[model samples]
Target: MCGIVGAIAERNVTGILVEGLKRLEYRGYDSSGIAVLDSGAIHRVRRVGRVAAMEEAALAENTNGQLGIGHTRWATHGGVTEPNAHPHVSGELIAVVHNGIIENHDHKRDELKGQGYAFTSQTDTEVIAHLVHRHYVQDQDLFAAVQRAVKELEGAYAIAVIARDNPDLLVVARMGCPLLIGVGEGENFVASDVSAVLSSTRRVMYLEEGDVARITRESVQVFDGTGAAVERKLHLSDVSLASLELGPYSHFMQKEIHEQPRALSDTIEQILAQGFGASLFDGDASILQGVKSVQIIACGTSFYAGSVARYWVESLTGLPCAVEIASEYRYREAVASPDNLIVTISQSGETLDTMEALKYAKSLGQNRTLSICNVRESALPRFSAAVFYTKAGAEIGVASTKAFTTQLVALFALTVTLAKLNGRLTPEAEAGYLDALRHLPGSVQHALNLEPQIKAWSDRFAAKDHALFLGRGVHYPIAMEGALKLKEITYIHAEAYPAGELKHGPLALVDENMPVVVIAPNDALLEKVKSNMQEVRARGGEIFVFADLDSHFHDSEGVHVIRTPRHVGILSPIVHAVPVQLLAYHTALSRGTDVDKPRNLAKSVTVE
Candidate 1:
């Protein structure tokens, strides 16, 4: 949940480092700092807030250098104070910036303290600096010192280290976290994400787990855990800096919500043009031949997406599908089978728990694996046997929007493909599904047209402290996603339940001050959801219904209705998702919360 950027260049890198941190602001951070190797010493400027303030301080101090490292830290081991900010220094010799948790920091800190190493900050990252300094004192070699120090670390981390004594070199390592080297002429860079270095280089090499590298202005050398020299392929990234910009939108969340139409269109058009087959995923159709069931694992928004897919997979393919939250699944005992297709969903594709769960599943002899993700080069896709890439394109908002919709589109395609392979789908049925898929973008755009109304409804929610979301069957997960979005950005306490389950216990929480959001698509459960809406009304709960146009919901004193376009059956979830996202966006706006970077949340959850 942190950002790291390092640069070794012929020119001054202070501005470059600051720009990189700015690009990484979407990842979310409490404090930011930069350590530049100038002349014979390392100079660091750290601030306990945004990059702008740190940059201002750096500019005032004339912080400039040919080699430097920067960090935007989301606190894990310590408080969000300047003393705990990254670019943590050790004895004025070593400077380190790290992402991910160092699990054994306590023991290491105790040992180092016994050896006269003074700890300045209550951070695990500070241990790395001291550890490197301890080794550097012995060999007087920065690279060797870092290599030796990392061997003792026990948990996930991606770190970039620079020594004041070795200004010409930068050392980096990755284990269970993402780290990549940006390939540039007469320069090179390292970042936890490609977005950080996109301005200076389009080509990058991603370091694998347990890999360490030494970078200089001219070249890079990578070594595996065993210390053998290795080669990592350089990839030409397709991400554009313009796409990461907010443009005319006030916040990235709002822009992403509005971009769903284009995002869904791009994702669907690619599969349509390719004519979905084995080519749509990693392996050929042969991989699906023996898959009789599906097991999906994911975390956060991706988990909600998986919950939606469970309904699609079972109904369309006649497969017994199960969805589990990655964090819970990884730590518990479970039954694993080779016939169960291990499907993992994530936007960043580097979600720590999901990745660990996949590894755990594979270790249990579940060889059949598939990853549905947005980034093609992320660890999940690279490690899985098959992958379906979602072309949502650089989702910078901490609370996902386009990424969630695009993932649903991908999962729907996957379900149809599996159904065809299992002989469960007739050609006529496939054609109907494809037609519905093609019209999804237009339907979502029509849903977007309801934003003015949704924004008006948000004014009512601005004063709300609690919300309840209701849906039935497949739309139930959509309700969960809606509740999640509201709480994520607006900080309003929200919960979701199947409409049938409202009377079980949630009904007691409903009152006049409570706003209940109902997803009432014109599907088989429409009548049931309407009944549930009435139940809420009986309890004096304020109801906001996002219904299909043909549902014929009327606006009453206690019931406010916002109609979406005509329902497209299987694709209704994608269309319904648009309004709820807008509701959360506008509600967050009304409450004056940071819609893009919500407090204590990072776009990518790289740590457990």
Candidate 2:
């Protein structure tokens, strides 16, 4: 993932660009840089570290300009070095900041080198700058030059370009990645995310695929790929700056962990207010009428959320369901049918693999597609026929907490809606499920109340280098998510398995030094999971059990029990997720790791 910001303003925009990069720090980057056009020349500064370091250097050098672009790079094409940072310049004529990968960069670089264009960095983005410069020399128009340059390039990319000769304009384009324009009175801005420009403007225009835009201080002109001018609807963004701020909590992860109650309540209440029909999604309930089977595709935390939905859809509607990782699903030759509802889940709708997977399914005639996403303006919602937006506002943490739980709430709603449409859910059962959904916020609050006890176990967990998470049935995916959170934040090697699968192979790794975390809810599979716990105990494995209040589990030597709130049956996974997130947070804290921005990971994976 990467962040891009560009601005053309009446006043000096150096501070604006730096502040915008700071707002995007949550995306995770290894280096940062900025380029500004000042008096018919391009001034550039790049640093191979945090934005703070680049900002300090920019301020010390008094780098100020009325037109500029900035970038925070997550290092895909090249290693972390100053020369590899963004705002890559070519012949002092063009400077570019890009968000996505350029697949044909190597070939493009070879061709550009043949033309006698010197290269300074080993980045796919540097090729963009050189290509733009090559075209600019012929047309002498920044907008037209960028348009001509992109025609030769291939891959997912959102780029912002600035020219030394054309100081009054900035050109931006988007293909598979996301790019938006922020509108102001005497200023215009472009960014990969709304948060980066939230302070300067609340109104924005999101560019569609293959659309290129010429932005100036006074006006914005958007043109499609065919050199024809077009209009893009401007939206008044509802995201407040306060939602992005860390108020009482020490970290964004901690704040997001506690914000789950409100997030679930808002998502559920919005649906309840809408009266829970097909109208809850983008297309009405008729989209579900012909759906015979469900195929869910996603990546990372969203994939696990889809995995949980697999259990719900199969049990509730008797519809066979399958969940696949988006990256793998996009490449494999899978069967697609019109009756198979293709569902894609993503916290940010711009996840490249998931977006491509949805497109691949649509290309194969699986047109009954739906997207569950957090950002209403993201690409997935716009591409899919139906969409359900999760109300987990502004998840800043790289390891998702509120976003994942809110996704579960949204997926559950989708499942029940499908069940009702298929006549599988009786009115009584629907009412009961609705009641449980209404009480979910309170149950999540009860789960958060156990944080102190979870924190008490963090020191011990931090001392260990490996952990094993176990659960049964629906909670098995929850165990996988827990293990993912732990390893993602704490840098511990962790693995998860269905409690019953322990004897297949993983039981051989159990010992006194291994900490086995169990999800022990008092469901139908509780006895089986308990039997699995005894197997770990028989191997002298140190067991840490997060049990339901009525699970009949007690603490003993080598077997530690921390009882969570009463289980809510089908909705237990959402409740059980909070404690695991807290455990990851506390353990990462004890280990002195960055809880919000983990190493080698970006919050939104825009590239493959």
Candidate 3:
């Protein structure tokens, strides 16, 4: 989840790199640094705090270089310190910034030390600079040296290497992580994501695994590992400052929570339209013809979205869907087959665990992998046999909102496609569902209006120390996601209990000091959730409910109701998510957190 940026320009590029890092500041980090090649010398500086501190240090040093690389690091390999910060250089032959881990670094470190390669820092990234330096001294070509060095690496990494020997060039490579090369009129750029190089260029070449590139001021050279020149298609990416902005909101979480309406609307547009244009949205029926099982792999909020999607896929398409937490899937050694349809979900598409799981599943015999990601030209999409792009735009907040809603909408589209393919859904059923899905935007908009209602009830939970989140069926995972959001940002003690599980043991924790925030959407399981709410109310616990008007849910002095738009049972999770998002947002705002850049949490987890 570190951010990396590199630039090769006719004039100084350090300022541009710094500005680009600022655009990526939403990606959490503890330290920031940059290394620029100036006058055949490597100039490096870093600070031990936020990106702003590093910017101040950059100005103080007056470092000027036309070719440079920068990194914002959330420490994993070593402690957060100036020495451990990125742009690690050894002997000035090579300077490197890295994201991800080197699992066998200690063995490699011992070997390199035996070879008389000294290091100044204790980072696995420092080993990269030394490894590159050793190869650069032998090959003299930075690109070849990087390729040879990367071939020896054992773990995940997206590395940017700069050399003083070649003042006008930089080398970039990616394996098990994301790296994009930006092509400009007279300059070229590389970054972990589009935000890092959006200031310099909009045209980018997303590097595939084992692909290496040498970037210069006037051109970019793509190469295969065997020293053959390769052609790369320029993928125009939708990355811009306007999408990254928080707009009228004070926190990005708030902006995202409100944007759920349009986010769902945008996703449902092409999916639910006239005719048989269901699957692939453009009427590509091939997506639904496969006879197989669906394996959903994801982490964090995206994982909750997957859990909710599994219910819909099984309900509508009559297909068995299994959802797994990406981090644990490989360890469990799950089985795969030719008819195995694996689907990976991620907002950034660069999530380390999910990416690894997707690759592992795709490589196992005959399996077709599909990715539902918001990022276009992302690593996961490139790796998948098929891709479904979610138009969630840029979700800057660490706590996801719009991305979750859009992913659900995308899954709904897939379910419809599958039903259409199997002849399971008649025209009447399809038309009604599609029409309801089309009006989902208006429903989400109605739900968004309840922000003020939620805030008014926010004071009721302000004095409470712990909260109980309860839901049934599909809403159960929404409860989990809500609890996660509350705890992640507010540092509050929260727990999610499936409504039916409340009386099993969690009932003992209920008291006036506990706020039971029930996801009581009016569905078949409404009575179960309502019973759970009553169970808490009997113990004098405050009841905060998110429900539809038809539940006829009464609002008492101790019971506060947050209304939701009436939608399908499966899609309710996506709509019900907005209020919980607001609850977490207001709770965190009350506690004063850097919502956009949460501490110790990166937007994308690029390592296990």
RMSD of each: 0.8, 0.9, 2.0
Lowest lDDT sum, 10 consecutive residues, model 1, at: 281-290
lDDT of 2 by residue, 328-361 (tens): 9999999978899999999999999999999999
Query: Model 1, range 181-269, lDDT digits (tens) per residue?
Result: 99999999999899999999999999999999999989999999999999999899999999989899999998898898899999999
- Tell me how far the alpha carbon of residue 293 in candidate 2 is from the true structure, in angstroms, after superposition: 0.3
- Model 1, residue 512: distance off in Å is 0.6
For each candidate, the alpha-carbon lDDT, in order, equals: 0.92, 0.92, 0.82
Greater TM-score among 2 and 3 belongs to 2
TM agreement with the true structure for every prediction? 0.99, 0.99, 0.96
Residue 396 of model 1, lDDT score: 92
* Angstrom error at residue 484, model 2: 0.3
